[model samples]
Target chain A: MGELLLMKGNEAIGEAAIRAGCQAYFAYPITPQNELGEYLARRMPEESRVFLQAESEVAAINMVYGAAGAGARAMTSSSSPGISLKQEGISYIAAAELPCVIVNMVRGGPGLGSIQPAQSDYFQATKGGGHGDYRLIVFGPSTIQELVDLTGLAFELADKYRNPVMILGDGALGQMMEPVEFPAMDEVTLPLKPWATTGMKGRPQNVINSLHLDPEDLDRHNAHLQEKYRAIARQEVRYELENQDADYFLVAYGTTARVARNAMHKAQGEGHRVGLIRPVTLWPFPDAAFAKVLDRARAFLTVEMSAGQMVEDVRLAVNGRAPVHFYGRTGGVIPSQQEIYEALIKIIQGGEKA
Target chain B: MTILVGAFGSGKTEIALNLALRMAAEGNVSLVDLDVVTPYFRSRDQKEALARHGVRVITPEPRVAQADLPSIPSGMEKVLGSEEGKVIIDVGGDTMGARVLGSLRRLLPRRHSLLFVVNPFRPFTATVEKTVTELRRIEDTVHLRVTGLIANSNLGPRTTWETLLTGHEKVLAAGRQLKLPVIFGTYPCFLNGNGVRSNLDLPLMPLQLFMFPP
Candidate 1:
């Protein structure tokens, strides 16, 4: 068994990335996730791996693209605004179909918002933060341990689909501390990247490019990308359902899901029928979760730390089979368990008016 | 006055918060949140809860309370200078974080006990040598001598008696080298009244207060 240790979410992500055979790491330091860079800055050199604090977020992301294109397991991390600056490079990385990991420890943001935690980047992470029809496999972990586990898995998934994978966490997850046991370092087995642009020896040159000037070629490439995305959606949907027999459901992800679960238990204690659906994989959206509760769901409440970004996806998933309601706290304020339980009470009492 | 300082994620904020709450039972108490490193997970986040216990929390102005800039709250000197209450100051983590203390060194009360919290589970403070090195670095940065050691070795929810016992030994050895007393080992309050006890001849503090994400 691996040794169990207490770690902050940011530090755990750094340890996981190193264990997953990440050869090159580049990043611009942003708080909430600053410790990740600090941890890597000290550990990467000790492991004889690469860790570079790039000049800017844009520069860091492009460095990841360059490193990943050259067949290295590459990664970069940033908070919300910094992540916004890397959109063009992320788009290119997705279009080029290179494997890389990007971590967005989202903070309050429409601009240079507050440094507190928020889930306002749901649209950016799942719907594609950059241009084009490409999608990144996004994991929304609620705990520090989950942050560690998902980070290692993000690397493997990124390579499997030959596309980018993002660990979409907010500052709460990044700053919080929890106990976690990491898989043994020897257990990490990396998939070979045969198409990587390593110098050709006895084989043909593996030329990697995102630009297809010919519209027909671009169309075909996009179709190929779409097929890969469809395969991922089918095979990689992950979620957790609690209190399935309850008549009302609360759908949430990340730390917000933790709050929903607390409220769910409180309502259950009061003889109210309440359940929780926590989507672990944000991109796949866990649409199947609704199938398990739709028959009895009085109303579906989507809770987030945003102005209801993920709620839109919840509404689409519900397809009007039941009323989809949203409860949220934006600008880095997290909704309390009492507030959520109250929301559930109103919905149960008002019969959809609430 | 009690000043808690340590490496980042070494449980300084949680320990400081709980200590202040515990001290509130004795008399007038004021908890000053002087952590300017990160905006989240500090004692200031629990201002409301602390106030409910009659503990005054001093933090940055309301306008920039959540800002990441290093702006210390005004009237800190007054709070430090006050003689009516026991002041518990929760400083930020690491030598870099302790840099904020440089500006407050002149205002620190001569009677204050600056305690260095050490969690053997954290990276920099994992060994006796590293613990001493890290503690010295913070002391050097702040220009204040740490008078005591707080052996707060834990792995959050994963803490076991074995983990705590073994970590206590490392911190104890570091204490011996530093010529400082290991004040007490802190444990999670959730584990209180569970028949768990430390066999070592060391005091133990049950920490019930924490700044959970809101």
Candidate 2:
């Protein structure tokens, strides 16, 4: 540990990116995530790094594209509505294989939703919010420590695969304060980007573009991208299993997982067999981990801050081997521990539909 | 007994909620939510939980809780004037938030302590100079000087023992420059059994989460 500090999730992401050797940050102010840009705005000048309060989310993400194309560790952060505006740029970044980090401190949303925390952007993040069939490597961290750790990992993964990675969080995580130890600056080592467009002084010029007019060329490019995605899915499916011996399990991610853990413990205290499976990576879905639980758990309840997004992935993983049920609080409503515990008990007793 | 004031996202509401719960264990305690700046994460949001623990909460009426304009409840003066027990005022973030306190300054007891909760993690109070600037602005707006400083530095869930100490040092330095006493330090209660421990001799306020989970 380099130094311990009590930091908000938003501020921690900013500090983690800086310590991870991120050289450029561009973002427009939005609720629950404005602190990130504000933090970098104050620190970047002191560190002699690039920090810009872009005119809009669209411009900010495009700036990320420009910086990533120039071979610099770059990032942009926003909440749900702001993220919607950047989808076009995100697709372009993904198509061009520009390494960058984008943080979505999600709030309730369909249109201009409440500024309170919600996981309603599950599909947008995991299924690709932009046009075309691109996927963002999404990491859903339950704790602030995980947020810090995963933020660093997101940058490295973005660089490693030359693909954009996202750190998904909600208003609760972003605004809440927690104790964190940032990695020592010397501890982080980044791979050299040989394909970076650094003026091409003594080598062939590197052209970075997402527009390939030829259908055959586009097909081949997408095939290569799909291969990379498959490799990532095979290698980076992270999840946490608690009380695996229990007959009933709850599936959740991000802040919902924190509450689910509490609910699981409560159910256990009552002599009921209940466990939790928390997916750390939302995109990879952790289907294999869910499969391991299928044999042991009689039923799985998917709890989320959204209506029922990740539950679809859970159902696909369970595949009728076990009953898959969903319980959610949408539009900025967070479910309570007691509520989840009761729901699990209802499911276990066969009183509720699964 | 105390008035907690600080910059936005300084964790004052969390500290206030915890302090109210602690005080309620000993005597009748009332928590006043004077935050009119941010609609979310206000102390009033935990009214039911606090009331269950015998802590009286005075906040804006339900019909106007989310209103953008600052509307101090009429019941607030009665609670502030009561001679029965301890009272905690959780002022909103920044000098603008502190402006609400100006109207209630006359009702505050002379012996009450005005604590400036310093969370170095917040961008506005990240440095000693910036912290001092915020403190002065709050003092100016509320027309009351902060009697002491409380280092409540934290990074939401990423806070560690070192985070508190690092913030403590900067807060202590700021207090010395401002000729104010460093009163106490705070750490989240969740870290109690964790390997990290606070070495600061100052009194510790083990903050509890009052905000709803995301």
Candidate 3:
């Protein structure tokens, strides 16, 4: 085991990126997620890594694209509004098949809503925020430890798939402190990037462009991307099932999943057969993990800090086999354990007749 | 019972919250959120949770709690003057934030301790010279000499035993330069049985994660 340090989720992600052999970090300051850029600003100079506070979120993400295109492990972080500005650059990176990490320390927003944490970006993340047919392997970690572990994993996944990866979190996660042990720097092994546009010293020139002028060639590229997505879905579906034998199940991800865990234990203390299904990988959806509890669960309650984003995925996973209910608190409000427990009991009781 | 002052992002709020929770076990504890610099990550954000543990939190009135502007409630003097329980003031980040303490300095107990929390990983305080500069600025702004220093060197999740020791060394250097006592050094409790132990003779504050899980 490595050394344990108390860390906010944002700082954890920053350090994990460094340990994972990231060479460059580019970001524009935004509330909630600024700690990450600040952390890197101090450490990157010491480590002799590239750290740039870009002119804007757009410039920051484009800098990430430029760095990743040249085969350096690169990352950028932002909140909701800043993230929106990066979508065009993100699309270019995705289309170019560049490997990089983008962290969204999400804040509440349809516009500039609130600076507090919210999971409303679920659709923007998993369903592709940028234009064109593309996908980002999204990881939603509920614990600070997972934040560290998954950040390292996100880097490796991006490299292995030659695709962009997003670590989706919120203000609560970004700001909250927890104890985390980072993997040793020497222990992390990065894969070879043969396609990197480093130099053409003795080989043919490598072109790193997302633009495909031919319609048939674009269709083929899209088809290849879809194939890669299918392979990722089959290989990277990650979720955790707690008290799988219970009659009631709560489905959640990220910070909301942590809250639901506490609520599940409380409901169990009340003699209610309640369990939790926490999705660690939001993009792959982890639909098959629901199958383990499907036979015994009377109903599924989808809880979130958003209106009803992941609930749609849960319903599709259940596929009319059982009832799916949703409870959410938006605009940066986090629901309490008592509220989630009560909602579960109400669903279990009312669900018997339905 | 204590006043924690430091540069922004130095983990003072977390330390104050932990100290308040610890002190609450002994007697009634009141936490005053004097942080007016940053809108988020204030002790006031955890008011309800702290209240559940019997820690009285004196924050701005409900009408202005959400506002970005500084609005110190008038009740601050009353709470600072109360004789019933220990009081912890979580001053905002930097000398600018410490300036708020100038107005309430006269009300503070004569023997109260003002702890300068030093996290070497933070940009402004990374060097011994920079840390001393910030310390002097806070002391000047608050009109109170720092009685002690608390070493809180960490790199968030990427922190190692070496990280803490490196920070402690910087604090020790700063302490020698400033002629202040290095009162305590902190390490995350997760390292309790991890074969890494502090070599410093100073008291160790084993920090706990008080924030809600991410």
DockQ list for all candidates: 0.63, 0.36, 0.26
User: What's the lDDT for residue A208 in model 3?
Assistant: 94
Which tens-of-lDDT digit does each residue in B1-214 have in candidate 1? 9999999888888887888888898889988888998657778778999899988899998888877878898899899888888999888988878899877889877899999999998877878998998988998899889999999988777777778879998999999999999999877776754666667878887788565543
User: Which prediction has the highest lDDT against the true structure?
Assistant: 1
A296-348 per-residue lDDT for model 3 (tens digits): 77899999999999999999899888899999999988988989988888887
* Candidate 2 vs 3: which has more DockQ: 2
Chain B TM-score against the true chain B, each candidate: 0.96, 0.94, 0.94
How many clashes in each structure? 0, 23, 1
- Residue-level lDDT for B101 in candidate 3: 92
Candidate 3: where is the Cα deviation over 4 Å? A351-354, B1-3, B7-11, B14-32, B36-39, B46-64, B67-89, B93-114, B118-145, B150-178, B182-214
Identify the CAPRI category of the predicted complex in candidate 1. Answer: medium
DockQ measured for candidate 3: 0.26
lDDT of 2 by residue, A1-354 (tens): 764566778888998998899999997987778678767987789889999989999999999999999999999999999999999999999999999999999998888878788999999999999999788999999888899999999999999999999999998899776767788877788788889998978999899999999999999999999999999999988999888788999999999999999999888999998888999999888998877777778999999999899999999889889889899998888899989998898988889877
Q: What TM-score would each prediction reach against the true structure? A: 0.93, 0.83, 0.81
DockQ, prediction 1: 0.63
**Interface RMSD, one decimal, each candidate:** 1.8, 3.8, 4.7
**Candidate 2 at A5: error in angstroms?**
1.6
What is the total number of backbone clashes in candidate 2? 23
